[model samples]
Target: MSCVQTIQDYGLRSLGFGERLLPREGFTLCEQFTLIGSGIIWNVYFGALALAAGFLLATVLAVAKQSHNRWLRKPAEWFIFIFRGSPLFIQFFFAYFLFLSLKGASSFFNPFTSAWLGALIVLFLNTAAYTGEIFYGALRSIPKGDIEAADAYGLSGWTRFRRIIWPTMLRLAWPAYTNEAIFLFHATTLVYFSGFPAWQQKGDALYYASYFADKTFNPFVPYPIVAFYFILVTLGIIAIFGAVNKRLNQHLPQEARRKLRIRPQVIR
Candidate 1:
């Protein structure tokens, strides 16, 4: 088949569109690209939704961790420590098992066993803890003089936090937050590999890549294709986050603004 025909046949294959069975034999370059590209929709879905939900939760976590009251602070501290100290792989396994046990208890909990809900829950909490630490550090690093300035202006409690403290914390944390965002996207590939089963062969980019590899005994082709798609997606993330980071740092002098860098470390 022509390249155009192959693309047309498999472009939306992940969504149960176009080609139904995938290229069984004679897997062309066009087939690999189209199928893997189609699989990317899952990655984007997991990453984007998890990031959006995690941001709000992280903000609350950061605030709670910084609270003077022990009731609020201790739980937040323990949460951050627990999530951040453990491996995400283990988290995925434990979460899947936990959900499985819950499903055994009742039909209502069965939905938690599925990839869509289970993976999202794990990713959300993981990202929240990581981003919470970043925001907490930024909150602590907020210049002491800023608080005094807020006090001088009679900006107290919610008003002070809303106007001055929160903005500065986000500004300070934006660079690290961008790094967290990138890692979270990469982490989505782990979902299918974990305990969550990819129902109906519907899976992410890495999932389909692994499937092809096992079938043809050729890791070289499929894995590289998966990596290429991830690289493109990662670059797209950097672009979007870079724009937001720029806006966050816009008020500062050019030299004072933090430059975003990618340093993948063990946060999950």
Candidate 2:
């Protein structure tokens, strides 16, 4: 079949459009590309939503963690430690099961057994913890001179934080936060493979890739397609975060501001 025809058949298949049944046998390159590409929608959706929501929560957690009061600081500290210390894979399993058990409690909890809500919750918390740590470190490292200047100018409490501490925290935390964003995007793939079942064969990019691999016993074709899509996504993320990072540091001399770097440390 022509490439166009193959895409027409399998494209958006994850949404229950186009072909109702996936290719049962003799899966072609075009089929793999189209199907996996269709699956990329789910990945993008999960990553975008989780990351956007996590950013605000992370800021709150970071500030709370740095609070002088033990009541505020201790909980935030333990939260960051627990989530950051555990493997994401294990967290996925544990979260899925925990949600599963909660399903019987209410109708609202039932959605948590599915990837949409289940995976999103995990990704959200995981990103929050990582980002919180980055922000917390940045908070501590904010030059004392900056705070002194803010105080001297009669800035205090919320005014001081909004004008001085917040911007500095963002500037210092951005590079590491960019790394966390990339890792969170990659981590979205683990959702379907974890305890949550992909209802109606609706799965993310890695899910469809793994499906093709199992069907044809050919890992080469499908996995590479998934990887290529993820590379594009990773680049897109870098471009976006780079723009934000630039804006955050625009006040500083070029040499004083550090460029955003992608360091691949394990999240947990």
Candidate 3:
């Protein structure tokens, strides 16, 4: 089949919209590219949704952890510690089974068994803890002078945080948070393998890549295709974060702006 035809057949195969069955034989280059590329949609879906939700929860957790009250601070600290210190892979398995148990208890908990809600919740909580730590550290690192200046202007509490502190914390933490995002995106590959069934083969990029590798007995072709797609996505992520980083830093003096660089070491 032509490349266009291959795409038409498998472009949405991961979503089960096009090809009813993946090619069992005649795994042409076009098909490999098309299916792998199509699978990236799911990866993006998982990463994007998880990151959006994570950021909101992370902000609240960060503030809570920074609070002076033990009631607020200790719980946030424990939550952050538990999630951040553990391996994400283990968290996935634990969450999947926990959700399954809950599903048995109540019908409203049904969605928790599926990847959409179950796996997304795991990713959400996991990333929130990681990102919350980042934001919490940034909150602590905010210049005392900045807060003093805000107080000088009669700003306090919500007004002070919303106007002076929060923006600066985001700006300071964003590069590291960008790395967190990239790591989280990479981490989405663990979802289907965590015992959450793909439910009609609608798995992410790595899922389909592994499937093709297993079927063809050729890891070279399909795995590299996954690598290529991931590299492109990593670059795309860097670009998007770079734009946000730029905007966040634009208010700073020219020399004060830190250039966004992908630091994989932070994740490790």
Candidate 4:
């Protein structure tokens, strides 16, 4: 097939539109690009939803961990420790089985059988813990003067946090959070590899790349295509986070603005 025909067939294949069955015998470069690109939709979905839902919970966790109240602090600490101490790949497996066991226990829990909700739950909690730790460190590193100044203004409790502490914490944590975002996006590729079924070959980029490699016996072509798609999206994510980081530090003087840097994290 020509490039245009391949694009027309597999462009939206991830959504189960055209080309019900993936190309088998005659895999072309066009097919590889189109199918892999289609699969990227799932990556974007997982990362975007996980990051968005995790942000507020992560902030709450950071605050709880920092609280003087043992009831709040200890639980928060344990939650963070449990999630961050273990591999996310392991979390997905455990969560999938746990959800299956509980599926019939309640009607509200029915959605957990599917990857759309089940895998998302795991990713949300996982990213929340990592982000919480980052925020906790940033919270502790906030200048003592900032709190004292809030006190001088008769600001306390939520007033102080809303107007003073939270903003500064976010500013300090923004860089690390940016890296965390990229890492989390890369981590989305593990969803299909885990217990979660694609439900119809509707897997992510890596899944499609592997499929093509298996069919064509040319990992060189499909894998590079996956890398190309990931790199493009990763750079786009970095650019978006960079803009947010700049706004977070906007109150500081030009010399004090923290530059965003990409430091790839290795889980092992």
Question: Between candidates 2 and 3, which one is better according to lDDT?
Answer: 2
For model 3 the local lDDT of residue 77 reads 95
Give RMSD (Å) of candidate 4 vs. truth.
Answer: 1.3
TM-score of each: 0.95, 0.96, 0.96, 0.96
lDDT of 2 by residue, 105-154 (tens): 87789888888888899989989998999999999999999999999999
Per-residue lDDT over 98-128 for candidate 1, one digit per residue giving the tens place of the 0 to 100 score: 9999899999988899889999999999999
User: What tens digits encode model 4's per-residue C-alpha lDDT throughout 130-159?
Assistant: 999999999999999999999999999888
Judge candidate 4 against the unseen true structure and give its global Cα lDDT, from 0 to 1: 0.91
What lDDT score belongs to each candidate, Candidate 1 first?
0.90, 0.90, 0.88, 0.91
Residue 191 lDDT (model 3): 86
What range of 10 consecutive residues in model 2 has the weakest lDDT sum?
259-268
Better of 3 and 4 by lDDT: 4
> What C-alpha lDDT, on a 0 to 100 scale, does residue 87 get in candidate 2?
89
Higher-lDDT candidate of 2 and 4? 4
State how far residue 217 of model 1 sits from its true place (Å). Answer: 1.7
TM-score of 2: 0.96
RMSD values for the candidates in order, in angstroms, are 1.5, 1.3, 1.4, 1.3
- Residue ranges of candidate 2 with Cα displaced over 4 Å: 265-268
Candidate 3, position 224, lDDT = 91
